[model samples]
Target: MKTARLCAGLMAVLVLTVSGCSAADQAQNPSPTSAAALTSCPATPLQAPAGNGQAPQGPPMNELKVPVDTSTSKVIDPAGAKQIQCGRTQLKTTDDVAYSTATLANGTAKPLHLDIQVPAGDSAKPLVVYVPGGGFSSANRKQTLNLRTFVAESGYVVASIEYRVQPDGATYADGLADIKAAVSYLRTNAATYGINPDKVALWGESAGGYLASMAGVTDTDPKSRVQAVIDKFGASDISKLMADYGPQIEQGFANSPNPIGQYITGSPAKSLAASPEAVTAANPVTHADAGDPPLLIFHGDNDRVISPSQTLLLHNAMTKAGATSTRYVVHGADHGDLAFIGDPNAVSPWSTEPVVSAMVDFLKATLS
Candidate 1:
């Protein structure tokens, strides 16, 4: 059996930054109205990491610093909120981390759920909201339980959320809306959950990675804005995806009629809304701007489901806009399996230790 290659040399070209976009540049290219929908709530300023130099390397699973006691602070009640709930049955995980499932939002089609995992002994820790990849047609919260546990054991709270899926008659906007709602709900109930709202980060794989990219770029109120984003092999441009792989997508799902079409066409209105000229509007790169959060992108060069160019396009746009960004290309890796089994032919291998370690390190540095 061949062990997975780290491609450490490829990691060297990851971090790329350019001059920040000026006010004049922004004035010339105003943000889309849809992207501006979430700006009503002002976000708290991001906390500066202690000592501006390189963060000291610590143990792989060090405990996070405990937050200030908020027992006496005015606690905002979230029990009655339609979009928020707590005190649910705990889910089982591979580790001893404590976890609970909460309904973040009640959608018209179905309720959106969030599986929240916390470290053994910490309060008010930074948060990592994970979006699972299922091509917008299936929810993978349960499928990613181990990954969530790994993050929780590293002393951060992990919330793996369920958004509306296209097969269930959800449009891309509906899914995106649910994710934004989850972020808002998490921030609103931060005091109750002992989460540092200001330090929230977003992580997702495949389709979920695409959603994370959109969430990071789309304009939203401060409360829902993420400080950092980790996108693992996500499709950033829907139009490009259709253009490049329409034939393959059609053939792959031949038994099931128009899977891609169903995903892109959630509702007749939304389909009509995306005019020919605005076809790429839903693409994450369309919303890239200077105000976007820092991004860490991972893509497999051999990925066939979604081409590596999708990640490259988003990274290029982000760099041009002067946002902090990094891209790591995995050689010989295809889609989601490369991060774990190394062999794309493996049958559901769960050994994603290396990928998990890289993500944990990035989270620690960004959310610390």
Candidate 2:
């Protein structure tokens, strides 16, 4: 009954199609009754045919006329020419990769790991080793992974590496060694990770910044020396922290549990007071020379943790030593704040804004 009702309704809506055949031919090749062929009514609505194959000559262009030359398009000669275009780069990530096993201060074995973000291709890419900030204690490599992913997608391989922190009975020197080891590991395995060992960069935030600077300035190992260094509001001189900020800053970090305390005999004040041997060893400015790579330094004007003066100190040292250095002061940015990146955290892959854009531009200029 439903089928009959549906067909009856369709029959009312279905228009007759034109058939240009003789009546005798129509009797021999009759259309099939839909009831005998299709069990269900068709879902598509009927469309009227445009017209029969015929045209009527009506009006002519009697009054309007225009004169113009015939146009010709020249064929572009692209023969034997090589054109290159960069495609949208995708990322491949590997986490918890042990880059090195180091003997700690207690003579115990400790493994350092790195989380890598590589563009998904076989083409060799310049590398960026990202060091995170925990003053000098934390070891979380993926702390700012969203930004690392953004960098990888921009056509570089980024490795967020682990180093000895305060709890590991490690100081900046130990951490620097670990960072260099990580670099050596990545460079040796460059083919596996699709990276250009010759073109490498050290990028870090806070204490990580300090380490990156140290690695760039103090060392010249072909395997670990970086082509560029980007320091984000990292401390430059621990011995002068008291004079730089104030003597009161010393009282706050008077204990060993503090980030700087475990790395050296001084939390910060002891180094500020006596300028300890450990402090001098950790300071990048102490080893600044013309041999240093180009550095891109960013500091927030309102940073309360590590003063913006630190950036100035490093930049001045680099300049005095005849090394290339560029500095940008981000207004209203606090220590390790998103303001340093010139973007917000409400995103997956971070945006290429004033900060990211500056970094990429510097990398291309220096590395390329």
Candidate 3:
């Protein structure tokens, strides 16, 4: 009954949608319903199609799919770079890592890359999947090395992924969908990759961090898909940020890598639908349960992009739910400034070894 009512409400909205557009255009070219819209209403699980081919459960996956575009991609070969060997022993060498590609929610093929610092060996060592952040627009796979390197050196297999950027119609949800797909893909092909599907961990930075948190909090139907999550100074509530930090967001937009106008369109309802803060109800913190995997978070106190409160909120939520968790705040560090967190000679002075050390310890304790 609830599902039927939701579908009815959506139909009403769709009726009004046609009248708002040019009749001729509406007649000749219909505006297809977004997969998100078609699927269960807000706060519902994505369901497969029903008998009539009308997607009884929710939106059709095809509508939200993004195809891979190779022209705009760059693959950096870590050829001469140092490599770290894994499996309980930390060995650094100079070897190139291997990478492949995966399709996004929009059907777009994005690179699925990894640097195997630790060969999981015959033990099926726990795996950590890292997602890179770009505010849905900036950065790439390399910038996350500060954390990835630590995980690799700590005897675990690390899979770093690349996803579609926003403002290019790749909206925030697109990013989440892409990551989720990657997670599912990895789980399915774990044996081939020498990973233990049962002990997978999701890690992300900034926007990717927020997505990681969301995935951790939400159940993928059966309730045990993602085993754990780690967020790095990511905005959890998107709507809240837009409403509370409008001016700051506006400024960030001006400095964004892509045109703000394009990126803004991905979320038709703006903060209500895609903003990090707005989705807190579905946040890993709020949804955290005993069955959920543990959480580990790290953020700099001086972060101007995403305030420290975001980390605290998530931490408190997780803690309250009795989920094993940890929150680290570097006193003077800013976004991506882990490299400057402390002394320059200690292990990895520039890259916040202290924080990475904690993360490694956490993953080992929880995953192993």
TM-score winner among the candidates?
2
Q: Which candidate number has the best lDDT?
A: 2
Clashes by residue pair, model 1? 38-220, 38-221, 39-221, 43-222, 124-194
> After superposition, which runs of candidate 3 have C-alpha atoms over 4 Å from their true positions?
1-120, 221-224, 242-265, 268-290, 338-350
**Per-residue lDDT of candidate 1, residues 143-179 (tens digit):** 4444565566677778878777665666667677777
Model 1, C-alpha of 176: deviation from truth (Å): 1.2
Per-residue lDDT tens digits of candidate 3, residues 1-368?
43334323322221111001111211221114332222110111122344685533322101111221212122122222222211234433222333446455477665644434345356666778777665555425554443465466566777776666653346555566666766676676777666788888888877668778877777574323677788876765433332223454433432332322224344433433334443445344556665666777766544445555666666776767877667776545445522112211111211433555567777877887
Greater TM-score among 1 and 3 belongs to 1
| Alpha-carbon lDDT, every model | 0.56, 0.62, 0.50
TM-scores, each model vs. reference: 0.63, 0.69, 0.60
RMSD of each: 19.8, 27.4, 19.6
Q: Write the per-residue lDDT of candidate 2 for residues 99-133, one digit (tens) a residue.
A: 99988878899888998988987779999999877
Clashes of 2: 0
The global Cα lDDT (0 to 1) of model 3 is: 0.50
What ranges in model 2 sit over 4 Å off? 1-88, 242-245, 250-258, 266-272, 338-352
Model 3 misses residue 311 by how many Å?
0.9
